[model samples]
Target: MQKGKIGVSSDNLFPIIKKFLYSDHEIFLREIVSNAVDATQKLKTLASVGEYKGELGDLTIRVSIDKKKKTLTVSDAGVGMTSEEIDKYINQIAFSGANEFVEKYKNDAQAIIGHFGLGFYSSFMVSKKVEVITRSYKDEAEGVKWECDGSPEFELTNVKKERRGTDIIMYIDDDNKEFLEDYRVEELLKKYCKFLPVEIAFGKKKEWKEDKQVDTDEDNIINDTKPAWTKAPADLKDEDYLKFYKQLYPMADDPLFNIHLNVDYPFNLTGILYFPKLKKNIEVQKNKIQLYSNQVFVTDSVEGVVPEFLTLLHGVIDSPDIPLNVSRSYLQSDSNVKKISSHITKKVADRLNEIFKNDRKQFEEKWDDLKIFIEYGMITEEKFYERAEKFVLLKNTEGKYFTLEEYKNIIKDNQTDKDKQLVYLYATDVDAQFTFIEAAKNKGYDVLQMDGQLDSHFINHLESKLKDSRFVRVDGDVVEKLIPKDEKQEMKLSEGDRLDLTPVFHGQLPQRGKANFLVTFEAMSENDSPVLITQNEFMRRMKDMAEMQGGMSFYGDMPDNYNLVINANHPLVMRINEDKEKDLEKDLKGMKSKISTLDKRRAELEKAKEGKKDEEVPSAEKEELHDVSNKLDELKKKKETLLNEYGQKNKLVKQLIDLALLSNNMLKGEDLNKFVKRSIELI
Candidate 1:
């Protein structure tokens, strides 16, 4: 027997391994099982190279838990290490400067184990004592046993004869006795080894006999030696890929399509990415893409491996080039990882373009489901945007689809405004904005349906991409103002008439929740609506963007601003104008005469004081100027009050305002009831 301490520079190595080597103590099982698999694969390689004449029998790895004894063992039929090989590989940890190593790698335990050959020592994280029994494949070799008790010291000695393989036995500690549970061990195996290259058996198969589960004679294998990602793409059918997708995500809706990625050039990468039917809540569907290294599951949180937008996809990505235990910093700086990400983005764009060009009908059928993902990618990744622009679609209110260039060409001749800027009118909801949509259609203009989750951000993105273009919601303004032509029409009402009618319209505006309206005039045909409700395009867009992104809360806190545009050419507005002139003509004319005399006196007083300093100006002149301004303000207020009183009594004024409000889906309850009763009385 030979006993000695592990060749490490620090006595704190065991404690560090236990406390900080791995983020989760459960990963010890993965490390140990992976080591067993490495040994088995090495033996196969040697046998194929004519280096060993041994029989390559079943290389199944077995995991067994003994609850009573508190021991969990992983046994494998593969190349075993001899005494000399064990001294070089297991006993000596090759790192120097123990203090610096601990300081640099304290927060990264898994990275330490993977970088420095410390796989076997990971068992110390959850075990009080670990033992290894092995027999090399060499002829006339004897079995050896090695044991350690959570300390630097270890014992190595000769043991009884055994097959050419290895066995790792771990005595679970008091705090980690859960490792000794059958269900716990089985769960760990399923998580880390479900798709491993080697067959792994947890226990005997179970059967339901007399309403209770009982062990059967057959061994229960917990891993599949070959998963769908490991095979050639040509061998798989669409149904096969779909079946594998169902296996990965049992409760999810069927994926729209898939991309089979197989690249061996600069780096080896193989995986299948499925486009899941994503919902509006993007955060809920993240972390669904599992990452694997040589068929061994590594992580499901692959934000670092793939582009941020690509994480919305679901499936598996297996690459032998990526290290089994990679650190966050390493992932960010690795060239291979960057290449892999770029390649994946390119592949996805290529597949989408292929489908779009070959079968556009099917593509349009799936656009409603695919729009959010495509728009998200366009907003996040610049390279993806460049490739995706060719296939990204623009769906119109008529349910017809067109690409960016195609739609631009179709509308370039008619939709270009006076300033040469192309206007792309869109509706968020067809039913809610039906009036506005019909108005646009009546003018021989096309309106797009931009109602997806990411359409707000996507519209902004397209504006930046498509030069000399801007997107406006159909309800953002009146049809004439949305794409104003070079021609202009004179207003029918004079400035004084407009000023007198402003308060009349303002008094009839509804008191909706958090919404403010500004009375304005637009000269349109008599056939148009009497009153139109429109929001400013830029302000509305800012509010919508504020809801989708952070750092723009200021816009969200502001009240909704709408424009109450009264058509000057409409018969109802003309009647209101005529009625106000006829009823308030005497009062308004007298008030205007008084206001004019006060204004003339104030103007003369201000002109006399303009050229003189305060001391030179007479005190009487300043006092007279102040009195005249106050009198003028009072007269104007009186005139406005009279107009408002007359407006409140005019049922036509209230009816027009209510009609506009109802069309905008803003009039409710009492106001709607009042409008209905008023309509019946008018009829």
Candidate 2:
């Protein structure tokens, strides 16, 4: 027997290994199993090169858990380490045996997974003690047993062994007894080794006998050895890809389509990227893309490996170039990772364009599901936006689709405004905004359905991309104002009449929760609705953007601003104006005359004092001007009070205001009830 300390600069190595070597102690299983696989693959390489004259029997790795013994063992039938080899590799900390072997057999060795020497020490994270019983393949070699008990001190001695392989036995600590559970071991194997290059057996296969599961004689192998991503795209059919997608995500709906990524040039990257049917809640679908290193599952959080928008996609991405154990910041800053991300973005754009150019009907059929991803890409990645513009589509309220250029051409002749800017009319809800949509269509304009969760941000992106183009909601303004021409019409009511009518409409406005409406007059045809409600495109868009993005919460905090546009030419509005003049004519005329006299005197006093020093102006004149201003304000208040009183008495005024509120989906609860009763009385 020989006793020695592990090669380390400090005596606190074991503590560091247990607490800081790995982010999660569960990864110890992955590290040990991966090492076993490396040994098995090395044995195959040696046999092929005639370096070892032995039978290459079954190379399956076995993992067994013994609850009674409180030990978990991972055994492999492969090239095992001799005493001298163990002394050099195991005793010397941070010395990777796989790295040495690969250096020696660089031409013949297959891909090795371990590059860092710290993987073996990860076993100490969950073990109270660990033992390595190994027998080298060399002729006339004896088996060696190595043991360590949570310390730098280790024991090595000769032992009898029949097989040419290695066995790693971990005596699980009391704190980590869960590792002794069969189901837990099986689950770890299935997660990390499901697609490994070597077959891994956890325990015996089970069978349902008399409604109870029983162990069978067969081995329960948990790995595929060769997944679909490792094969060529030519060998896979569409159904095969879909089958693999189901294997990855059993509960998810069938993906809209897939992109078979098989690139070997810039960096070795292979996987199938499925375009899943994403929901409006983007956070729920994020981190679904699993990233693997040489077929071993590394992580499902692949934010840095792919573009931010492409993270919405679901599938597996296996690449040997990505480091298995590194910070996300390092992965994001690595040049190769950036190249891989760029390549993936390009491939996705290319595939969509191919589908669109070859079979546009199919593309259109899938557009509703595909729009969210494309819009996200366009809003986030500039390169993706440039490539995706050709395939990005806009669907009208009539269920017809068109590309950006195609829609522009169709509407350029009529939708172009007086400033030569083309207006793109869109509606959030076709049914809810049916009146506005019909008005737009009546004016020979098309209205698109911009109802996606990300449409607000996407519209702003398109405005920047499309030249001389602007997007306007169908309910954003009146149909004529949405695409205004050079011709202007005069309002039927004078400014004074309009101001007087403002109080009448304002008095009848409902108490909508956190909503503010401004009464305004527009000259329209008598056939139009007497009153219509519209929102400003910019403010509404800002509020919508604030809902999706940060740093714009101030916009969301503001109340929704709406315009109550009263068409002066409409019969109801004209009648209301006539009624207002008849009811408040006596009181309004008296107040107006008084206010006019006070205003004239104040203006003369101000003109008399112009360009004079403060001392040169008379104090009595200043006091008189102040009185005149106060009297003018009081007369205006009296006029407003009389108009509001008249407006409250007039049932027609409340009916018109309620009609406008109902059109905007804002009339509800007690206000809606009152409006209904008032509407019945008026009828």
Query: What TM-score would each prediction reach against the true structure?
Result: 0.94, 0.92
Candidate 1 ranges beyond 4 A from true positions: 97-117, 324-332, 596-627
| Model 1 lDDT per residue over 346-390, tens place | 999999999998999999999888888999999999999999989
Expressed as tens digits, the lDDT of each residue in 1-683 for candidate 2 is: 99998886566466766554356888889888888888888889899999998897888999998888899999998889899888877887632343353244333222323621356778888999999999998898899999999788999999999999999999999999889999898888888888989899988999999999999999999998988889888998988988899888999999998998898887899999999987766544666888887787888888888988999999999887764432111233467778899999999999999999999999999998899999999999999999998989999998999998899999999999999999999999887788888888888899999999999989998999889999999999877699999988677888888989998888877666798988988988787789999999999999999998899999999999999999988888988998888877787788888887888899999999999998999999989988888888888887888788778777898888888777777778898898888777766
CA lDDT, every model vs. true structure: 0.86, 0.85
TM-score of 1: 0.94
Candidate 2, after superposition: displacement of residue 132 in Å? 1.1
After superposing candidate 2, which stretches have Cα over 4 Å from the reference?
94-117, 326-332, 588-631
